[model samples]
Target: MGFFDRIFGRRSAGIDDPEQLRRQLFDAAARGDLSRLAGLCRANRQAVETHFPAWQKVPEHLRSDPAAMQSHVQVLVAIAQVFAQQLGDASLFQRLMGTPRDNPLMRWQDALRQAQERIDALEFTAARELLTGVLSEAEGLQGSGVDELLPITLGRIGECHFESGEAEQALPYMQQALALCEQAGDADGVRIYLGNLFEVHRWLEQREPAAACARRLAEMIADPTAKRQRLRQAERVAAGEPRNRVLAVIDGASYELDELPPLAAGHVRFMFERDRITLRRATAANEAGEACGGEGEYAEALAHFERAATADRHDPHCRYQAAFTLLHLRRYAEAESAYAEVERLAPGWFHCRADRWLAGRLAAGDVEHDVFLAVHALQDGPMAPDEKLDLAEKTLTRAPRLALLHLLRGTQLARLGREAEAVAAFRDGLAGDGEPDVRSRLLVELATHCDGPQERAALLRDAQAPAGNLVAAATAQLLARGSAN
Candidate 1:
C-alpha cells in the first residue's frame, strides 16, 4: 500500500466504530490535514461548538484573521486530546500534541526535531521528505521569528542531503544558508553553514573551494583557541594538494604567514617546514631510483642522489648521503667531489677528511683496501666468520697501518670463537702507527676482548689518555666502574 494509505489504514483498524464523527475529526487532526479538518469542523460546526468549548472560537478566528490559523490548530489539538481520552487511544493525542505549540516557528522546530530523530534511526528517506515539507512551509512564513527559523531550516535540509550521500545537491542549500546567516549577523549559524560547505566540497574533491571554506572559517572564528584549531584544519586541507597547488592557494589568499595570529602563524610555518622536508626526501628517493641505495641500480641511484643534492643545495645531509652512496658504487672521484661539497656546506659535521682519504685510495684502483664492500655487505645481512676473515685479510694486506681494520679483524675472530687468534690480531693491530683516533679505538677494542684485569686496565688507561675521542674516555670510565665493583 502507499505510505499515507498504509499509515491511515493501520490507525483506522484500531477504531472499531470508524464511522463516528469524533473518530473522523481525530484522524484529520492526527494527519495534520488542516483543510480536511476545517471542512469537517464546518460540516459539524453545531456538534463541535457544543462538545469542545475551546474549538468553538476557532472558526470565528480563522474567518477573521489569517494569523489565527495557528490557534485553530491548537483548538483542534485540544479537541483531539479529549477524544483520545474518551476512546482510550493515545496515538491521535501524540500526533496532535507532539509539537506542543501552534506558531509557525514552533512548527518548523518540531519538523526539524522529527527529522533529526528519523536521521538518527537511519530513515533518510523519511527525514528528507519531512525536511522538504518543512522547507516549503518555512519559506512561506513571514513573521518576526521567520528570519531566525528559515536559515536553520535551510541548513538542516542541506545536512539531510549531505548525510544521504548527495553532497553535490547539498552545496547550494548550504551556500544559501551561509549567505542568509551572514546577512542576519548570526556568527554561530555562519560557522555551521561554512563547515557544511567545506565538508560537501571536500567530498566532491573540490580542493580549492574546500580550502577556501576552511580559510573563511578560520577568519570568522573569534576565539583565539578556536581560531588556531580552524587554521590547523585549513593547513591540513591545503597540505593534501600538490606542492605547486599548495603554493598557489597560499599566494592567492594574499596572506603572509607573519600576518596571522601567533598560533596560526606557527601552524603555517610548520606546514612550510614539513613541505620542505617532504619535498627534499621525495626528490632524493625518486632520483636514487630505489628507496635504499637502489638495490644495485648504482648508476640510477647516483643520478638521483646528484639530482637531490642539486635540488636541495643548502642541505649538507643530502650531499653527504649522496657521497656515501657513490662510495658504495665505487665511483670514487664523484664521491670525492660530493664529499667536498658536503664539507663546504657543513664544515666538520662528519669525518670528511678520513672519508676523502679512502675515496682517494679507491680512485687509485686499489681495491684491496676498500672498506665499502664489507660495510655494504653488513647492511645486506649478517656476515659469516669466513667472510669477515677474508675481508680482514685483504684490508690488512693493502692498509697494514689502518688500526681500525686490525680491531675489526680481532672482533671478527672473537665472534668466531677463536679467542687466541683474536688476541693476536688485536696486538698486531695495536702495533700499527695509526692516528690518535684509530689508536684509541683499537685500544678500546683490545681492552673489551682481554680477560686479564691488568691488561684490560692498561689498555683502557691508554685509550683514556686520548682527549679527542670522547667515546674511548667514556668506555674507560665505564670499564673502570666494573673493575672497582
Candidate 2:
C-alpha cells in the first residue's frame, strides 16, 4: 500500500473498471452533481494512477473511448469543485489538460492555459508573446464573453509586468480582477487573482497587506475545494504555524503539524545556500526532509526536494536531489539531470563510483563520464542529533567502512536517545582491524558517544601502546636501507 493509502485508505477505493468509472465521472460532471463527483473522486483518487501510470505515461481512461475521453476533458474543466480537490496534483491536471493538436478546441484551451503557466514560470517575454497570440485569437472569437476573456487577459498582463519586476504596476490589475472575481463569486478566479496579488505585495515589501492576503488564502485552502498540499502549506503559514513538521511516521503516517511563522531568514539561507534562490520554499519549509529520506519516505522527500529544485535556477544540490528523487520515483530521464548534477558537483561521490562500476552495464553514450559532483547541503554550523542521523544514513549507505562515518552515526544515534545502537556501532568499529592512529581516534570518538568515565578509560587503555615501545621493525629496516644507500 502507498503511504497515502495507509494514512488515508486503500488504493482500490472501489470504483473499479476505468471505462465504467470514466462514464460515471463524466455523467455526474455534466449533471453538476458535485457530491456525486466528489464521492467518485473520494472513492478513487488513485484512479488517476490507472489513467496516467506515471507523469509521462499515457492515460488509459482517455484511450478507452472518444466520448469518454471528451467527457473526461470536459469534466476536468467543467467541475470546478473537482479541480479544486485535485489541485494537489497540478502536474496531473496539466497532463490531463494537454490534448493533441488535432483537437482544436482542447488544443486552443491548452495553448492559452500553457501560455499562462509559462508566465508563472517567469518567462515573461515569452509568456507575453504567447498570451498576446492567445488573446488576439480569443478576442476574434466574438462570442467569448467578457467573463471568459477579461480576467485571463488582465491576469496574464499583470503577471508579465510582475515577472518583469514591475510589482507596482502588477498590483492594480490583479486587485481589480480579484474584486471582480469576488463579486462574481468565482472561487477559483478569486484564488488566481489573490495569488497574483499576494506575489505583488510580497515583492513590494508590503508585509502587513501580504500577510492579510496570505491569511485569507490559508482559509481558502481549508475549504475541501482547495485540497492542495502547497496551498495547505501556505494556509499553515497564514494560520501562524510556519515551521510545520511533516513527519512520515515509520508506520506510514505522514504527520503534518501547524506551529509558527517561518523565518524568512532561514528560507533565504536555504534557498541561496547553494548559490541562487529557488522559486518555492521546499528547502525552507521542510528542513526535516533528510530525516524523512532515511525512513523510506522517498516520495514525500522527493516532493519537497523537487519543489525546491523547480523553484531555483538550477542549483546543483536541488538538481541532484531532483534526480535522486526521480530515480527513486522511477522516472529515469527526469532524474538524469539530477544524477548529472551529482556527478558535476562531486565527481568522486559514491553514485559516480557506482556509475563507473556500472559503465559496462550501461550504453556507451549513457556512460559519458565517471565523475560526479559533491553536494553537501548540511547546515554550515552545528547539527541536531536528528539531523546528524539523517546525514549518517544517507552517507553511510555509500561510505559504510569510513571510521568517521561510524563514529558520527554512533554519536547521532546516542543523541536521538538510541544509546544501545550507538554503542554497538562504536564498539564494532573500535574492535575491527585498523592502524594505531585510527585506533586512537576511534577511542576518542567512543568516549564521546559512550556514557561514563569507566568506558572512556577502557577505550583509552585499548588505544595505548606499551611505554617501552620503539620504532616498528619495518621502519627500522627502512632506516638501515636508507643509511646503506
Query: Which candidate leads the pack in lDDT?
Result: 1
TM-score, candidate 2, is 0.33
The local distance difference test score of model 1 is 0.63
Write model 2 residue lDDT over 1-485, tens digit each, in one string. Answer: 67775544333346768778776766877897666666566677677445542323325755556565555556665433454554344544555545645333454566667876776555677877766666565552322244555676678777776656566888876886788688778899988887777767755656556666765776777655344444554444444431111121223222232222222222111011111122333344244456666566878877767665544433345555555555445455556555656555433232332322223222333322211111122222267778767776676566455444565567667777787898887776665434343344456556655667666556555544321011111122222233334
Which segments of candidate 1 are over 4 A away from where they belong?
Answer: 1-294, 311-314, 340-354, 364-381, 433-438, 452-458, 461-485
Clashing pairs in 1: 287-304
Candidate 2 lDDT: 0.52
lDDT of each: 0.63, 0.52
Query: Runs in model 2 with CA error above 4 Å?
Result: 1-124, 132-144, 158-170, 203-205, 218-404, 407-421, 424-485
Per-prediction TM-score: 0.38, 0.33
Q: Candidate 2: deviation at residue 84, Å? A: 38
Model 2: lowest-lDDT 10 consecutive positions: 267-276
